[model samples]
Target chain A: MHIVDGALSNPVLIGGGLLAASGVAYSLKKLEPEDLPRVGVLSAVFFVASLIHVPLGFSSVHLILNGLLGIILGWAAFPALAVALLLQAVFFGFGGLTVLGVNAVNIAVPALLVYFLCRWGLSAEKHLLAKRVADGLFLVFFLITIWAGFALYQLYQVEGGSWSVTVNSVSLILFSGVMAYGYFLYRRGILSVAGFWGFLGGSLSIFLTAVMVAISLALSGEEFGKAAEFVIVAHFPVMAVEGLLTAATIQLITKVKPELLHAVR
Target chain B: MTQVLGEVSRSWTLDKHQQTQEAFLQSLDPRVRLLVCVLFSCVVSALHDMMALTLALGIGLGLSLFARLPIWTTVRKVVVVDSFILVLVLTLPFTMPGEVIFSFWGWEASREGLFRAAEVGLKANAILFSLMALIGIMEPSVLGHALYRLKIPIKLVHLFLFTVRYIDVFYKEYKTMRMAMKARGFVPRTDLHTLRSIGYLVGMMLVRSLERSDRIMEAMKCRGFDGRFYILDTMKSGPRDRIFAVVSAVTLLGLLAVGYL
Candidate 1:
């Protein structure tokens, strides 16, 4: 998740920048010429991946895939993240050079976690190919499941709501349910008319919100609006639509490329 | 979208790229330019006045023109830096409570904030342009050497160098991954699906990169890379370079007074 320029102080930016630079340096130090190409390519994929946004709550959350990046780059995910973010900042102006450090930390840490889990749990199977593949699959499930929970926990903290993380059925429904839904949507629609449905459904909420916002503004006169009205009438639906769109878009990508779901070592 | 993204090439074979780089080095001492860039950033950052910020931007623009770097390129480069400052600017007229010029969602936009935004906008633009020129002039290799000579840890220099060199490598790897995905007749599934796919994609990439690193280290061992790096590069600092450094430093110091005091 981007810290959205000016989300924190300049000092934070500098501190984050230092960390990002150091993290990248650390990643680079461990790199070989051969590894360099893969890092660069995957970072580019990560770059492209983030461009595809899905609605999530009040905001559209693009996939950072940092967890996956970590699984590949290990600590080296830092440079991959930094460089990609730098490109994004330069090209899309999504983030700025000043805040590159902070953004990298946000994305790279989770990626590192996935990388470690993958290396230890999957890569350990040197002798048996079958065992490695199976174990890698298991590890991927474990990593992604944990990542889902972690993201929710983070969401709770950011929302100033109950810090209480209910990891049970409700929370599971909130987290795993979405993943399952996307899986279902993806598998069922590899092609056919489903693609349009997928795209339509993916962006439907955002489009709906726009319609509603437009209608509301048309109905209600400006200058008569209050804070409570904005939240109750405007904010909540935008958030819900955002979440739905995010879910749908992510599902679309998964459906198209199943290998992205391959278990990592 | 592709065109807007600019020409995607890491290796520049153009003579101009080399000439521009040489011209920069020919102009001033590396240490002085680095200090001026860093110091100017500091002074401009601390002050939140529009007039002062504009002055800085004007100065930066003037410098760029003098340097003979295309004005459009500088603008593009400056915008990258500007995004960081604009985030702050965009918030100013809304968050800071003052005379209400505009209000929405129970939030009031203040007159002061607008002016403050202007100040920050100009200041940030100026600082960004200056920094951009500094980077434009100095080759990443030269920077690594300079920093190393200036007592920055050798590890840091090596790290920076490796990062710069491998940046293109990562880009290439990423393209392959995308092609691989596309070959599967995959269309992106929307939300969590996309995240999951991306998650796996990034994970696979990281794993591959590290594996490649191991092989590379082994390869290097087959050659010779005793940890301490020997610089084959030798840059002679001239009297003109020393004078250039002094002038920039004095200029920055003078600019600080004009901006701050």
Candidate 2:
């Protein structure tokens, strides 16, 4: 979700701007001069990839592929994603000028987090570590789902019922189930270690991006609470699609061009 | 699918052909244009008064007219942006608690929420229109160079430039692969096969792009290229740029005064 201009408060805008600028600077520092071509080319690849709309059902969804970018580019995802976003804003008017920083942070932070959380699993030797990480994440999400279920039940009892709350809680529980099934598949050896990590990173990045977008929106004003919740719920399908796509992509990359995965780091 | 491809190709080439046309914004100094765009966005986003926001939107529309941008295309793009914010705007009236303006399905739509939504809509449109008029007309390479002159990090600028340079290339590559898949009778649908095939396509593209980058690196090295990139086109602010800057500064200040006081 690209947040349009003027929706965010001044404080949130400034904070996001500063954070994004520093991220770009830090990533730039980590970038060696020689690595420029590779990073830039991959950045272009990502930009084009985002333009590719995958048929979902009646409608289609464009690939964000931010998690795959993170896996391939590591720290470089910040600048890569920022550049892509700027191009989108300028060329397509999809996003605006002022909210660029906030949008960048919302999309790229999850990418960076994915990089940190899943890079280890890319190695065949780290299969055990990958399995453990997947299981741990599954347990964490399971616990969260249970806790949120209780809270939602309490909310429903108190407020009688609200459509937004019901939709939100149900989607979240469904989302957790999706994650658990993904992990279950990984644990059952249906997916390779790298594929599992790819699935995790892909879906997790989208999940986190949706959450961050929601937080940014809700933090701006109390009136945005409903819209913020709706944003997360709307992204559930995208998360599952991206997860499966990333898993397949990572599996292919690991088989054919494994060096590309570690090229940036 | 072909319509989507056509749209992508058209948008990519749209401004390039238009750049040859003598437009007011195309004639201005890129750095001034860029700075004014950023300033306008900042000021417009900060403005809360509906009157001032409306004025800002007028200025935006006026600039687009002066820039001689395609009228229907510009309006269509603005509409696209509005559609994106529609969710937030539509929910506002129902979500915000205030004096009820209307009741729909037992849900009260608030007057304050309606005003807030209108305000957001105005601010967003104003900034977006101005931004498109000012910066969207510039060559992306020129924008990169302008950022470099504006003292943005050189590495970031280089990345921007290189990314801009290669997006077209990779887009063509993507089209080629899509064509090959189409030749093989691969129709994209809502299925695991489609997802996996697209994923494999992306992976293949990445693999090829990386290999191409390696060759590109060697080509550059063979030409005695170093880490330092030289800027050949020096931007100078002329009398026209100076006059435009003054007018913009005054207009921005006037908008702020009208909005705040």
Candidate 3:
């Protein structure tokens, strides 16, 4: 997901830089001096978390965990991730200097989105409301599934099933299957409301991040369109894996130290 | 787990050892180095001409040599970064519509696409090599202080400092926890059980770290910490830093002229 230097257009790069700077400034204003230690500590934890690569079939994928970060840090996720990205670029050369802003925006915006979308559903006290929200979220997912089905059909008619189209169709079907399972569990009272929200937040954040990365690439040039589509298709497994991991992590946090979920807010 | 820990520690600790070495790049003021790196990267990324991009890459190699970066290790790092964009570089030639260079299985590889791919590869490597030389070798905390002096938000800098300080501490904590899991006959695989175990491990780490932070906050408060960190070592740019800056600016401008002409 780290777009290298020179891959992006000038306008996209500048726009990303401006947006990230403002996000850092705004989050800094909201951050209390005393809260610095906690946020910093959590930020370090996230940096380590990203280093943890979980197995997926014959290969392994490193954890992004931005969804869990958003659930924990809220707006603070932006600065924490920006600092992390900067560190990665400087020390590890995982990303480039000029494209740091674009990379941060691609990763952090979904984190911010998940923070707003999932924060309220994290409470057991709001079980009913959380359930309602989860249902509404699944409703949105159902609509997306329908839309994806149509898109897949249209692509098949036009392009007759390229690699990207196959991957897209298969992943969307897999995702819909996962959503159906979650909806089933929620209805059966197998998954708690908070767990359900965690599942949604985890997967939704990754999905959005993948989409944003694709958009940034596609917007950069016409040549990048295929690569951009491949980017989104490739991240489907990551989204599923992160979703389950996030749900499990949230469940553990709620059981061990519930306040950690609410600490940032 | 041990290999991962070793890699992390190596990346973080290697710079400290280099800081003690009498390298030319290390002698320059970090703020000047930081500014020059950002400027150089910005200029290189905008260049499209092949000759200019190659020249920019040569300058990056020169910077790395002056910095006295470990040759094989620096090359390996640059190669690793190039591999990240291997997909983009490979696909560009076939994706763009232009004069057909060759056809493979009915897929046309265009001349324009191949050139674009080479340009991207060159630009990315040039920036990466220079960036690693100038900024990557700095002590992480010193980099944070440089950012602070450069008028970045103090809170963000503070956060950066605290994070740099504790990444090692938490990684140690993480290693111990993973050891315990290993002792319990736990092995990770591509399964829900593995994901759940890792997730639980991460949650446990976060809980422990938060508790540790509370103790850290109390300890600092006892020392009468007023949220301000005093810099005992002042950063003063000397004559050498001035010369380096001037030379770098001229080289960067020259690269820009080459790009346009």
Best by DockQ: 3
The list of candidate 2 runs beyond 4 A from truth reads A142-181, A184-188, B1-21
Give the top-scoring candidate (lDDT): 3
Instruction: State TM-scores per candidate.
Output: 0.59, 0.92, 0.94
lDDT of 1 by residue, B1-261 (tens): 133244332222235556455444335656566666667766666565556667778877766666555557556656655654554566567655579988866557889767756765665566556655554455555655666777765554555555555545655676688689889875565444554465456445544554565565676667775655676665556686687677777776667777668
Interface RMSD of 2: 1.7
Sort candidate 2 into its docking category: medium
List-wise, what DockQ does each model earn? 0.10, 0.66, 0.72
> In model 1, how well does chain A match by TM-score?
0.51
Question: How far off is model 3, as Cα RMSD?
Answer: 3.1
Candidate 3 or 1, higher TM-score: 3
Sort by TM-score, top down from the best: 3, 2, 1
- Between candidates 2 and 3, the one scoring higher on TM-score is 3
**Candidate 1 vs candidate 3, lDDT winner:** 3
Q: Which residues of candidate 1, in runs, are more than 4 Å off?
A: A1-63, A69-265, B1-31, B71-88, B104-107, B176-204
After TM-score superposition, the amount by which residue B210's alpha carbon in candidate 3 deviates from its true location, in angstroms, is 0.9
Give candidate 1's TM-score: 0.59
True contacts kept of 3: 0.82
lDDT of 2 by residue, B1-261 (tens): 122211221121224557466665677788999999999999998899999999999999899888777777777888878999899899899889999989987778999999999998998888888877888777777788899999999999999988988888899899999999999999999776897899899999999999999998999899888887788777788798999999999999999999999
